[model samples]
Target: MIESDIKRYELLLDLLQKSKKEQDEQNNTLDQKCSSMINILILIITIQCGIYANVALLNEIASSEIAIIIKVLLIITLIGNFIALYFFIAAYYLKDFEGMTNEEDIIKYGENNTNLETIYKEISVDYKRTIEENKIELSKIDKIKLGFKIVTLTTGIFVLTIIICLEILI
Candidate 1:
């Protein structure tokens, strides 16, 4: 019976590890996908701003040919923006993006799509609301964690720099 219990525990650990790996993979893919979408969105905004600026410049020039070209460029920018947005909505930001992952893994891990949805919602809202809504205790904990991270990083960098300096001096 002891041996059977040990075997069961080991099996449970293995299953948990597998689920964690799957979750990690999904998170990585989502991160990459979202970042690309964000970059495209930024680029589109920049181009639209540029087109507006060009139109203003053309108006100042009062040249009909230049004004026509500027209008054509603006139209092209609008079409390109629409196509990019369509692709962004269809490929990167699926209406049911969270539905791609398995639901069963949540029960095993004690987490579900709801938490993921909350994160997505927070992302859409610029993540500020989530930060603001968190408990004050979490901020304190975060400060402690940040201090520890800074100390550790500084110590490691100091050690490396000292070693390099000594090697160079010798």
Candidate 2:
């Protein structure tokens, strides 16, 4: 029975470690996605500026219906990209549980003349709470990522449509 209990505790510890590692990996992924979104936003802004410059200076399609349409599409693209950027920025702000617990804390807790079972209970409660908080954060990040992706897709389609219209007009 004692051996079985020890094995169970060991298994729990291993599972906790694995969970934390997975969360770390997920955090890294979220960070990368946010960075990529920022880059996309920059690119979109640059392209929009170029399009406006061409339309304003060249006067190729100025004072035409196509110009109006292109301007609307540009506005839509900008709004979509801005919304996606907002979500990515918000996701970036979400905190991750890194180094929330330390070995020294565990050692100090253990040295308080607590039995193994009590220590385990305390650690387990803290671990579960931390895990729950992390899960909530991850969920929020995922939702924001989903929103960002949808906006990005919509923006891409709008840009493509605008390009086709411009080509026909030019």
Top TM-score prediction, candidate number: 2
How much is 164 displaced in model 1, in angstroms?
Answer: 51
Q: Model 2: residues >4 Å from true position, as ranges?
A: 61-63, 96-99, 113-115, 142-146, 165-170
- Model 1 per-residue lDDT at 138: 34
lDDT of 2: 0.69
For model 2, residues 1-170, the per-residue Cα lDDT tens digits are: 37677677767866876786787787778778777877877787678767756654424645567566666666777677777777777777777553556788778876887666666656666666676777747555675767578676767867685675657667
C-alpha lDDT of all candidate models, in order = 0.46, 0.69
In angstroms, give how far residue 133 of model 2 lies from its true place: 1.5
lDDT of 2 at 38: 73
Residue pairs clashing in model 1 are: none
> What TM-score, computed on C-alpha atoms, does each candidate reach?
0.36, 0.76
